[model samples]
Target: MSSLHDRHRAVIPDWITLYYKDPLELTHGEGRHVWDAEGNRYLDFFGGILTTMTAHALPEVTKAIADQAARMIHSSTLYLNRPMVELAERIAALSGIPDARVFFTTSGTEANDTALLLATTYRRSNQILAMRNSYHGRSFSTVGITGNRAWSPTGLSPLQTLYVHGGVRTRGPYAQYTDERFVDACVADLEDLLGQTRAGVAALIAEPIQGVGGFTSPPDGLYAAFRRVLDRHGILWIADEVQTGWGRTGEHFWGWQAHGQAGPPDILTFAKGIGNGMSIGGVVARAEIMNCLDANSISTFGGSPVTMAAGLANLAYLLEHDLQGNARRVGGLLLERLRAVAAGVDAVREVRGRGLMIGIELTEPGTDRPAPDAASTALEAARSGGLLIGKGGGHNTTALRIAPPLSLTVAEAEEGAAILEQALGSI
Candidate 1:
């Protein structure tokens, strides 16, 4: 018999790099568990980068897609579909935003690109402010705003845009002034940057919980104050909740709501969990801001019946099951456990995030300073122990992301945490 790794390597196609490929081959999934080709089951903690909120092959979502596929598969954007309308209405109602209007897209990147285009078109301003370490998408325009220098070879975008420090104000590449004075300084810097620009800014895009930036959640009152600053400068506030939205954050249907009653953003974008991995994305903007895109905007396969059905079914599943509440309750437990585990590890520095979006900041064992590759190595160890995780940070993967599915149960979470503890111990 061939070795598992050898067999997989021989059969696997080579069109793309098998990043982190192991001997195990995932065959199928149900709920939060995945079975490999060898029939050994493993718990799924990463949840397809936090998109599989309702879990894999959810019967309801599958049935909805099947039912819709049987009725009508595709529809042009020029025509309206009931599934689309229903999903939009349900999203609007659950989001607590009256008269919510939605524009559909194929993915998060497309949605972010659409939002950027619409903002520039409406404001007629090329200058925009994106938070430091923020990740919008990989599209050209979205990439222009992404603050991860590793993602962008050039220091800054050639376009007329600026990246302002966000999150807890700190130093280094992902500096987020955590202190009030630092935040004030950041605000001052923003003021100066905006003043230097010839025209007013179009928008300031930020993720409520910096998912790719290490799940950084800024201190309370920051967003409300930032909104005031934007109001003063007549700039739009765009909340990119692609990772934090759709009931994953708990206590709020959208991550923006968890930002401590900060005034509602002028625009909001979501994607990851919206379709439960069915390739759907959209933007919910205030009617006023949306009107800016009314002139020259069109979506081709945006709200197709297939995607719309998935969106509707996913939304219904989330609401009926109160997945958000589950995330909060379970996330709280997970966070507490992670913090306790970190407390025991001299290399563990901090644990941060909201709801199910958790991050473990690792450091050198003795100095208690950041360990460049320690976190990444720990993630590898965790993978070996059958737990999948994501890594984030600026240059070094110093942060470990634990954004499991909303359907993760207490028992599974306890097992994952135990395995994660073992991984940390090994590191």
Candidate 2:
């Protein structure tokens, strides 16, 4: 341990600067709070970017992981693993998609990659459509479908793939169309794209609630209408719920549910909340997509016994506590308080999101810059004041993203909000 400390004193990697690396070296966590190496306690409102759903060092999750590790850590997913099978069954049951098939991966990006591949391969087409301001993953194929141009530099021209109007519910480079007009325009563009291609399009991937896109949600009737268009064009609908699934959206188990859509997506991807800080993600598909998969579809380390155990434990804890209900209850309280705070501060342009996944958009007076600088400053201030937060959005990365653990107490919520309020005041 001392040798490790000495090595760390020598030099840190350049990649560490890429992210707003917090000064507090996180040593450990319990519940919604983490401790730094210096033994300072800080509230974790960000939840490791919303991955620690059940909170850090949760007893159930820790015990399960330890037990599994003690027993057997790796049993190549090629063989049967009870924990994996059981977790998959539970996920399928929770998703309410009858006869659903599950494929696991190590991260949300991997799950998304699998879903994209499955969609294109099942339909045997190269054309795919993704909404603007969307974020799927950093991989080549997934990045190709991401609409944020800044994510891929001009030199990476090959990454710039076909795109349609990202729906016009909210204003940006795309005109703000009425809900009906937005749906019609998106449908028309998709149909036109499909027609222009010699072979039919493969899939249309979208986030039920755009996570890194400032928590932007689709308009009412938009999802159903989009599904109708996809069905008409014989294209598959892939809901990228990597950030919005697992009951984070207080209204329903999945963000898509809030849209009141009747049918399920052909392929659904999930992560973030699966392992409660452990890396786990997966794609659940219906017969149409799953039937096409062969031996090559398996991920070498995807559903290993240890990860499966972690997922099972985390999910079990979530369900047992009815964490979904807690998210709704606490989220409602948090939202109300945030809205009130926004009203008090003119810098806050708007507050949006469902359940625990929420965003507070900041804007400057008479400036097109949506107060992104202020947002960054506020985040830094909040960290110094003992709270963690995240930022997202395209041109305007001014939205303060908050996704605390499901088990966060009402008082803890108030404390977190108070920290944000103080940070805003300082900014």
Candidate 3:
């Protein structure tokens, strides 16, 4: 009989990448570990691209899913959904936008698409500003604004997008500048770009931390500075918090809080961790922007009872247990430990990130050139040592991504760090 991998290869699209040369099929998970099909357990560091906000097989979330499924699987937006309304109320209260309104979708891509629709229609322009090295989503409309070439599949787009600087801090032309100077230069660039564009540019959409672009981000106040410039031009600011929301960043509940001087964004798009592995994504905006549409809009399965139950339970667990505080404590230690380990490895060009989202950038020893091979070798080595991690980068996939669940314990962090240290030594 043909192997499962062979069967997958025959049916699945070639562009859907797998992690290993011989990919391991996950069978089950509990807490911070997952067992492969062959029954080999490995420490899970990437948390399925940071979608699992809490521990794997969390009882609260699992029970909520089961109970909801027993009662009702789904109800379209045409009908009243108690669970959906309750969850939306919670999210709206949490969102800093005044007079907030919420709209649900099944994934981050759909959420961003909705945000784009609202911004473009409300502002009466298809022109947009996107940060360089940013990854929004896989949909056609989103791919147009994605500044990362590796992730963006085509040039054709419904909207006109202008790429901005200041997303990546270490390798750009302004890398050598101080944080203040870097922010100033980027603001100046934005000013110049707006000067050349039409007066009706719709909005500026950006991720608080670029997730697929190797977890890169600008200085703390970069977005605040940009917000000031945007206010002058009447441009809406959309914060894509798919990977950085729900206290994954440790110090802040939302990544945009790191740039809190400007208050909340005009629009916020979130997904991934909110449902704790359940498919729940949404857009939050002020009443005016969200209600701008002249016609009716609804998501058939977006606010399904099952997913809403999962989200409510997951969010409640996250808050009740103070997982954000746990993330701050545990992630701080892990970051320090990883930085120490990277300091001894010549291939590690930089270790950058905040909270639970961290990246280790690999380069040729004693040089600035990207070392994708080194990253690959280290990934395999770490897997061999019974640890599962992830790799990403705009520069040829040369960065290792480490984003464990927010509920990870300190002991788990130490163990993963040790395995990573061994893997780096091999590289």
Q: Which 10 consecutive positions of candidate 2 have the poorest summed lDDT?
A: 152-161
Best by TM-score: 3
Q: Candidate 2: list runs displaced more than 4 Å.
A: 1-22, 153-160, 166-168, 173-181, 294-297
lDDT of each: 0.79, 0.80, 0.94
Count of clashing pairs, candidate 3: 0
lDDT score of residue 129 within candidate 3:
98
Candidate 3 deviant stretches above 4 angstroms:
none
Which of 1 and 2 is the better model by TM-score? Answer: 2
Per-residue lDDT of candidate 1, residues 1-427 (tens digit): 8876677668886542343535346788999988778777777887878888888999999999999899989876888688888888776666555467888898888888878877887788888888877788877778888887666645445347687765633444335444576657667777877778888788888888888777876655667668778888888888898998987877677777756556677778889888888988888876767776556556778989999999888888888998989999999999999898888888876788877889887878766366757776787788778787887765443678898889889988899999899989987
Candidate 3: tens digits of C-alpha lDDT, residues 232-308: 88999999999999999999999999999989999999999989889999999999999999997778999999999
C-alpha lDDT (0 to 100) for residue 276 of candidate 1: 86
Task: After the best TM-score superposition of candidate 3, give how far the Cα of residue 399 lies from its true spot, in angstroms.
Answer: 0.7
